[model samples]
Target: MSPRDRALPDEPDESGAASGPAGARPGAHPSAGLSDLSIDLTAHEMLRRAHVLEALGPDWDPVAALRDEEAAHDLLYSGLDAEQRRMYDELVAAGVLPRRGGGHAAA
Candidate 1:
């Protein structure tokens, strides 16, 4: 879910007063909620997060990012030297890598 979907606590009630713990005073320290492990983001931090999200764009897909990373790793390791290929063959024979091509047919 996007960050905007997150709900902030301590929202004001219809009376415009900050609704918090029943006994909370009007000017109580903001850290009163820290004991609950809740963190209040600074304005600068929130802006930074917004900037990052904007840069990612609406079309960004986490699954696609993972696929791109895997493709990059495969390309980087695609060229195995003769000795490495021999070891890879041995490992494949021993079921270390499970099976060659990982069940995907070659292009």
Candidate 2:
């Protein structure tokens, strides 16, 4: 399901205001309840990891990084909260990852 499929009740609808409080009225927080516009710690970490991964020269290998299962798990799981961890686990279990044995896919 899309991120919109999972939204908090208190979240805003579309605009920039919040759902309520802080002088926010209903439908005021257009940005609220919108996970697509939100950014959490996990998202930040994933972007950072992507940058690091990209920095690895094309000629250089990704085996070391991918084979370090513990580190990979830790890196990916580090900033995730309970719900995020659950989603990550679900994704892994569902084989959303392109590689087997938790290693990076061969290019």
Candidate 3:
């Protein structure tokens, strides 16, 4: 039978008790038979998350955020001390970093 045609094993009653599957004990927890991996979000929590995304607005650019992160990284690593430059050169020689202009690694 198609999945939709099959009856659910445990349906909730009006009072939120489980009218459970065959061989299940009466008045067992509503989620007794469910997987622990599932997430249960209340209506208010779902609406809060929706509002947070909506507040980010249509002009929000994930790419711009990435570019800003890259800029910050560059600013932080722009000038390396002599010891740092030596370690960077060693990393490049070890194939950990790609070689860049003037034997420096890209920030």
Global lDDT scores for all candidate models: 0.67, 0.60, 0.70
Q: Any idea what lDDT model 1 has?
A: 0.67
Order the numbered candidates by lDDT, best leading.
3, 1, 2
- Of the candidates numbered 1 and 2, which has the greater lDDT value? 1
Q: lDDT of candidate 3 vs native? A: 0.70
Give candidate 2 misplaced runs (Cα > 4 Å): 1-73, 98-107
**CA RMSD, predictions in order:** 18.1, 20.7, 13.7
What tens digits encode model 2's per-residue C-alpha lDDT throughout 1-107? Answer: 36667546886544434335555446566555445555569988999989987897577666775668756755765676777757766776787843344533212
lDDT of 3 by residue, 14-77 (tens): 3334455644566687666666686677988989988988999989898999889768756755
**Which candidate do you rate higher for TM-score, 2 or 3?**
3
Largest lDDT belongs to which candidate? Answer: 3
Instruction: Give residue 32's error in model 2 in angstroms.
Output: 64
lDDT for each residue of candidate 1 in 13-83, tens digit (9 for 90 to 100): 43334466555666788675455556677988989989998999999999999899778757755777777
